[model samples]
Target: MAATVTPENPRTSPTISRSVTHTVNGSHKFVIQGYSLAKGMGVGKHIASDLFAVGGYHWAIYFYPDGKNPEDNSTYVSVFIALANDGSDVRALFELTLVDQSGHGKHKVHSHFDRSLESGPYTLKYKGSMWGYKRFFRRSLLESSDFLKNDCLKINCTVGVVVSAIENLQLHSINVTESDIGSHFGALLDNMEGSDVTFNVAGEKFPAHKLVLAARSPEFRSKFFDGLDVEQQEIIVTDLDTKVFKALLHFIYRDTLTEEVDEVSSTTSSDFLISETLTAKLLAAADKYGLERLRMMCESRLCKDICVNSVSIILTLADSCHATELKSVCLKFAAENLAAVMMSEGFESMKENCPRLQSEILMTIAGCEVDSCSAGEKSQSVWAQLSDGGDDAE
Candidate 1:
């Protein structure tokens, strides 16, 4: 059984014609029942009404008479569609879905359908239907007959079906504005949230592991985090935690935080000292993954808070791994404060243990000159010599 569209004016007959016109995205725009679904319309609740807008068309109708009763083997789905039409064209679109039944409720029956596309418009034709579908669809036409005063067709389908079909449909056109970036970002971000291997950082879910893996190579980062959540979506812009993570995550994403400072505050203390080893690991992992921002952070703590004492192990590890930036800072401190370093036995031992650092320090010490001559004595000596010369002349 096929559903049909009802005309507002009884004097005219119902007709649904579609035209595939070029839109912004280089694809066809399907004008179905005077309303458009862009291209690639999917079977879902959103387009239910539009699907039924064609004259003499019904939706979700299924007929299966296995030599049995009509009601037992026939079904129809309820759907409704409304179009904002202004005399000659449709301005907006909306749809409502009702139900899905495949005649035999005892055995779960699934119905598969397709949309037929042509040069101008598209047609959605269902393969199966029963008498119940015919009656249900016919009632929708009657209900929509007087909806609008414009003498156009009104669609009535049931509400609440999956809208998976129209999601990929795009228009044919050139999108050069930020709207293109924003829309694509929104869709990609939405898909990121849908993945399973992500984490809830603060409140937003992101691919925590993938972010760690993406460090070192930005190409790898882009590829690894390609389908993952973006900083803008999950990370709040104003919240301190989100802001901090945003800056850090971008570094992780792009591998470009070479000279950037990690904004640390009292809040950072909570995570590093009390919470999970995440902060520490992130720092080390950042260093390992070549995240300059994270490495700088570790370096800052290692330099400023010598009282932490345990940071030596980190410095040693970083130096052992040939963290050039970190090693330079450590070498500078040791060379400038050689006296204090020698007295502290720990730093002295560290210096002795590192041959490269020891060699650097020896070079710096050898080049430094210690002048013992006093300025006053040299002046007095010159005066005495002049006075002796005057006495000899007299």
Candidate 2:
């Protein structure tokens, strides 16, 4: 049997809500220049205007001078609204009106609303299909009325598009514990079973899989498979300690550093701190192997652990590795604690090793001092002030 324990203060689940709605209207005016002549010459003859877009679909207005059906030929004029694009099953409302040009505002309207008042808008299933009255108006009556003016007839079509609202629900549940696959890989690394390649780092040998190393590091890939001889098995790694190399391999196999670093600190000593020294070395190694994510992780840890004792060394390391964000953090920290930092040996090391970074530090300190001084206060050079305070008691 397994034991289960509940927390004293259980967290509540979070809720999320969403809603959206949109409507678009497009109007097209179709003009017939010689209305009397066109009506006299046509039965089963129609004219189509240029295609237009509305609500992400193409449409056109079709005008038949004579009635579309032979039953109503020479008696009524027909008009229709058509879908022109390759769209399927589009639901929309349509209105076709013959404008009364005499300014009486007595326009004739034929709409989907008049036919289906209880139901909803009409659905268009395919292209080249239409919806309207075949016998829209009597040809003689329309010609005599204000609908035809100066031998021209104007027809207006309005389409009102309704975009349906979309709603989504997201449940925010409590944190549930789960198994970590990285721990299993870490266990495999610890066991060192079925190893194919050996790396000798500062006189300590580390056995690792060639495939795993190549997958993790491009430098390892080229050295192991592209450039080096196939029979070459042993690689000697210099300028890096056994601990740092072990941590790098641990990251390659396990994809994490938390457990590996913790285990290393425990084995070495309870008081052994995971110092900026180790992190800086790891960051350098990560950059060399093109492990950008690992480099960023190391930079994040180093940024949080910045202090008076470690800021200078970390700043130099950041400059060397081209870690821009970490470099900015270090510069700010150093400028704030300039007096104490300048007295440290790490600062002296930076001054000797990276003069360009030293110049950047001076500029940052000057900028900070300039920002602090108000317009009423007398301006003093930051370097002059720092020089005068050298070796002075805090």
Candidate 3:
């Protein structure tokens, strides 16, 4: 056997080949309103979901209300996923879910994720190629189920395209997460390992780094300019409330509102969710420090709190703080509910101290097309008071 061996040609370079297939996945929800009305739309007629893309190909969900095949009568409804573009030989996995509206989390699902296919992923040979059931659900059973709520039905679809790339001896891939520099800075504030300055605010003190404070606020930067004498300088703040100053420091370091500053949203809470007095004070501090973002945040939070009870007080704050957007919202809200607002204690307080605001309210209710100052009226003109004394003089 050794004597009968033939010589073979030798190759110069080493090479490797690999073909990897994976799916690019996406999900879409399609809601059918007036479900009962759609029930009689004849056989083979389908309602399609809005086109959504996955793996650079267009797809849609088609729902047959009165069954796809006439032989099955109207007993069942059909669901299918069809290739929406003019592509050929596409492979995919499909899943259909009927959401339960009863809040019991009992969703009806037919999924490819849990099943094993012997021949692999389903292939769509042409543009109209589809994969689904002719009898997706029994019509009678589905109509009476918790899947239908308020004459509406919701269907969720998941599609996975099996045409991804292959990698051979590729370099390592790294997943970069979202930036969390604020939290680290926040931790630095908490530990106070090398705190250089202290703020004495209303008999309470907060120790913080001078550089961080200077970077966050121009007012703090101006204070630190020209170099200081003391290594750990203690600055006295007389005007701010203790809690307000604390919250302001937290905002300066953390770039977020404290737990005391709740979003005063009607959707989140029926009553004013934010500590109104505390946040108003915070806004004043933000304005004084040239923190525009923090000032706007405070304005936005307070705007959601506008109602008859708080509108007058909020409007006064808005005018004083120069929160134009919040002021506009408060004025509109107050004008729309003038009667209720006038009956509130906050409104009476506004009438006594903020007569200018009362005049602005009247202008808003009168549908004044221009600003009072620009409408040929002096900026400092005293507004007329409608009183019984005028009639007595007559």
Q: List the residue pairs that clash in candidate 2.
A: none
- lDDT string, candidate 1, 172-284, tens digits: 44757543443443344345544324434567545434444454446446755774554422332232354344445555534434243433342132322311223333455
lDDT tens digits, residue span 1-394, model 3: 5344345654434555577877889999898878889889899999998689987889988999998989964689899989999887888888999899999989989887667365578888888788888888899899899998999989999998887665665345578998898899899988987998888988788889888988988887877874563354888889887888889989998899999875554433333223356788898888889888899999988886787777888888888888888888888888777767888777898888787787677667666743645532532232233333346684
Candidate closer to the true structure by TM-score (higher is better), 1 or 2: 2
Cα-based RMSD of candidate 1: 33.1
Model 2, residue 150: C-alpha shift (Å) = 99
> After superposing candidate 2, which stretches have Cα over 4 Å from the reference?
1-181, 191-194, 258-276, 365-394
Residue by residue across 296-325, what tens digits does model 2's lDDT show? Answer: 888887776666666777788888887878
| Clash number by candidate, in order | 35, 0, 0
TM-score, predicted candidate 2 vs. hidden true structure = 0.45
In angstroms, the error of model 2 at 154 is 82
Best by TM-score: 3
Using Cα atoms with residue i matched to residue i, what is each candidate's TM-score against the true structure? 0.27, 0.45, 0.50
Candidate lDDT scores, in order, read 0.37, 0.76, 0.80
- Please identify which of the two predictions, 1 or 2, would achieve the higher lDDT against the true structure: 2
